[model samples]
Target: MKGLVGNMGIAHLRYPTAGSSANSEAQPFYVNSPYGVVLAHNGNLVNAEKLKVHLDQDVHRHINTDSDSELLLNVFAAELEKKGKVRVNDEDIFTALEGVYKLCVGGYACVGMLAGYSLIGFRDPHGIRPLVFGTRTKADGAKDYMLSSESVVLKAQGFTEWRDILPGEAVIIPKDTMTPVFKQVTQPLSYSPDIFEYVYFARPDSVIDGISVYRSHLAMGDMLAENIAKRFGGRETLSDFIDVVIPVPDTARNAALQCAVNLDLPYREGFVKNRYIGRTFIMPNQKERKSSVRRKLNAMGLEFKGKNVLLVDDSIVRGTTSKEIVQMAREAGAKKVYFASCAPAIRYNHIYGIDLADTRALVGYGRNNQEIADVIGADDVIYQELDDLVKSVLASGNNDKITGFEVGVFTGEYITGVEAGYFKHLENLREYNARFKQNSILAGDDPKAEVDIGIYNEGDY
Candidate 1:
């Protein structure tokens, strides 16, 4: 990417949600028509399958990949084509975005570049995804614009003046003028950013939708401490029950530390994380995820031996990692292992963007607190209450506009109401992918094989 030279460009690191993990499915997806536009999208579109059909039949646009991002790019292009303009302008781009908002449904934040014309950014009507932009003035007084899913990127690159792009809003920065035009292309349904951002996905340093991620984690810890105290009978009995608080690794560290401070328990780095190992929860298969947990973190005997240790993690998804970590703690001579999740039990599939396990595959699904504890081989399991989790995020920032959050994983009710049969469709896709992976392993094929299982395309039908 460093070798590529361009004054104005958009980039993306694909986290597979609505498509295959094939290299071809990666963004920034491009469309040659309607003035050579390229786009990078941050969230999943629930209506992608319907949109694909509309593009193919109504607009005559051919989609190459199974990616919804490609569908999104072509959607905007088709809308721009409707203008019948020889040369497009900022207004046309925003009008195209209005079409996109109307046609596409679900949580998405997008950044697009119109060839030799403009850079564009927009968000879903519900604001279930995060998008922010910032500007820096060049020495000649021309302003350089940047758009990202997080504020940290803008600040890191010295774009000091920044603000979140509002829900249902679009921003167009023309290359010729270098001036950005902002507009609310559609009426916002709600101002609900995904709560999972604070729990797992985002960097602690980044602020999303005016809420500081770091501060939210601290608040989560405070809430978790209160919950833990209740579990231990009272706040005064917390020290009697728990010997040490140990964070699972990087993401849980902040909350764990704050939890320890609130509970007056000693916080210890009980597990040494191997920085090279990628996050195990997002791993494609259960087998890989199960194996990677051991490689990712090693339990220190000194911290666990003869002690009643409380393990803190951001969240327990499939319980593969948590179960292994608990076993490791026991092997390290811990007398008792009490597991704590900073977020509530994630029982439903996260259709927004984060590719959590299927609903049935989740540890929390069809399980009470004790059942979950038994599955994870812990003495007890503590989950953050949904209300407390919401409060934790709300306590941190300018949350006046945010009346709620996209918490489908916890509640099974989404901001954009789920379409009929979508959950079944999503489950089928996941099962197919899992089977494909198993077959690849048996046949000794590349694990990352480019096998398309017809997720968002016409093939699914």
Candidate 2:
């Protein structure tokens, strides 16, 4: 609050994966007006493109990025300007922005406004993304409220003791008053975070929807060891030597350690990350996939040489990266390789916000586990059961139950009828109906995924 800066400052970085792969498309767009509102968003907005179209025509706003924050700021600034006032109340801003969104389907979003009369913060109802807030009192006795997609970012800046913001809830902070206003924008949509995210994307240190990301993977690793034992009970074959549990780079480290503990085997980091490669799962097509592998993964000669190793990873979506990695491991003089998936088959594509599209493009879409193992060149593969998945990722205790949105519906046991013809942000789908015909690559019932990043081609992984 006090001594913050000349005009307030906010920073944002993009982890662009599941969609396009351009830095120009990154986030943290700023107003820089006397208003000086700097906006950053973490997750996807199902309707941001639509909102952009609305802003372009109705408000004459041009978007710098394909993100919801840009669309939102345009709407807020336009609405405020339309009201012909230098400042607008929080209620007035939220009332104008509402759209259909989901959690398990992806897209957790956070919005912040600095150098404005009042700062507003919000999260998707399903909380598909993560956001945390902290407050500091300035020398001038003004309150400074800060928000980030991850709490540790603020913690690194000396912000601590954060509380989770419920989905669909918005908090308004004013300079003159320490008092805050809370408003509900829409209903809760999805689960806190996908179980796979803990096994992969999120930092193990984070708490997603109250679930400890690291701890859950530890449990998954343990479960996987048990599954492996059951699969190869009393075999004692060359492949059953059980030399060491090798993790697939960063995401599987925690789970690999846990698997070692569960199976009483040694653990080691067998693959080194490129440190410069982006997640190919987030980018579209096979070019990024090849580049990501060449730039992202390397074999650990010492850990893999002439040894029968168990390679553990969070999930194998395209089977491209994992396949290449496995081949490299074999070339590293490994006697045998066994692969394990910490979660069950990702057959269904995520409609939320993640990059996973539909079943057609999914390597495991029409294939079974053994088939996937063959494709990826692993000697054996095992996966955690779905029930155990929810149990492990969501904290277990009378008080540690999982709730934020109806994640049970995620299994497709219950379906939220898809809303169509009204989406604003997603383009290239006007031909999704009646005109769409199935080709060799587009053979599926899902219309949304008939094209690139089509929802139907995205397998569960």
Candidate 3:
């Protein structure tokens, strides 16, 4: 990567949701049929199995990996092949993308390279995932273009004037002309971005679809503060019930700080996070997640000693990490531990890109607030109201397009409508992966094995 020099390229850090963590499944997936194209995708495809069959039977393209990104790459390549032209133009590429939109059903944002021709980026019809692009002016007055999932990256790299790619829109930047062409390939079904982006996934510094993630979290804190006050009878009595507001470090820090300020309570960092550990929520299996909690964070006895501490977290999907953290707080000499979530209880599986957990495995699935508290060993549990959470995001953004958010994890109602039988498919995939991982552990084999790679070049495009 350090030595590679290219005028146009696409890159991806694989966050496994659709397939196993095999090295072969890593992106940028390539296809060479009609015109050489490589693509890296974010988010999952609900109709991937159906598309796989279509690609195999109709398009006659052999899929080598289980990754849906690879499937997507092939889908685009197959559509381009239908053009039946040796040299394709922007219109041809966009028409192919229209074909992709007609077939693929799910949330996705993709960046692709059409060999030496152009750099392409597009988003799903519902705008369930994020995609943005920006430009920088060079010394020679030629503009350089970049695309990313987050605006923060563009801004950090001096790519000013960034804006989100609209729902169902595609942008193509030609290498020869250095000009970008934008088109709405499909009519948008809706303008809902995933609410989890503001709650957890995205960095606080990022502004997505005109909404500031940091501000939204602060608004979430204000909303949760009101709820917390109501729980203790009144704002005046908040300090009587809770001594300090301690965030489950990192993601919840902004919300916790604001909540403490609103409640007029002391804000303390009760847990010290180990910067080296990866996020536990996105870990592949339950066993790894459970074991990593302690390694990721340690309780600070000074902040918890003999105090009634209130813990704030982004959301609680499975009770594993929260339960362990509660025990840690108690051991750190906290008198009583009360837990609060800035987001509402996630009872449903996140079907988009985030692999939360199985529906039945979720702590909030069939449990009330009290039951959730008991499971997590907290004296009480406070969850943000669904309406309040939605309001928090809406109030922070000026985007008229974002009328609502994809709150499937809380309401079990996805913006893309329900994917019938998708849950069972997801459950089976998780089970198989878990079993494979366990077997690998028993056999003393590495679950993630490397694969060979080769380069191909056609005589002259």
Highest lDDT against the true fold, candidate:
3
Name every residue pair that clashes in candidate 1: none
TM-score, prediction 2: 0.75
TM-score of every prediction relative to native:
0.94, 0.75, 0.95
Q: After superposition, how far is residue 248 of candidate 1 from its true place, in Å?
A: 0.8
Q: Per-model C-alpha lDDT, please?
A: 0.88, 0.62, 0.89
Residue-level lDDT tens digits of model 2 in 59-80: 6665544345556556655555
lDDT (tens digit, per residue) of candidate 1 on 314-411? 99999999999999999999999999999999899999887787799999999999999999999999999999999999999986988699898999
- On lDDT, the stronger of 1 and 2 is 1
Clashes of 2: 26
Q: Where does candidate 3 have its weakest 10-residue lDDT segment?
A: 452-461
Question: What C-alpha RMSD separates each model from the true structure?
Answer: 3.1, 8.1, 4.2
Better of 2 and 3 by lDDT: 3
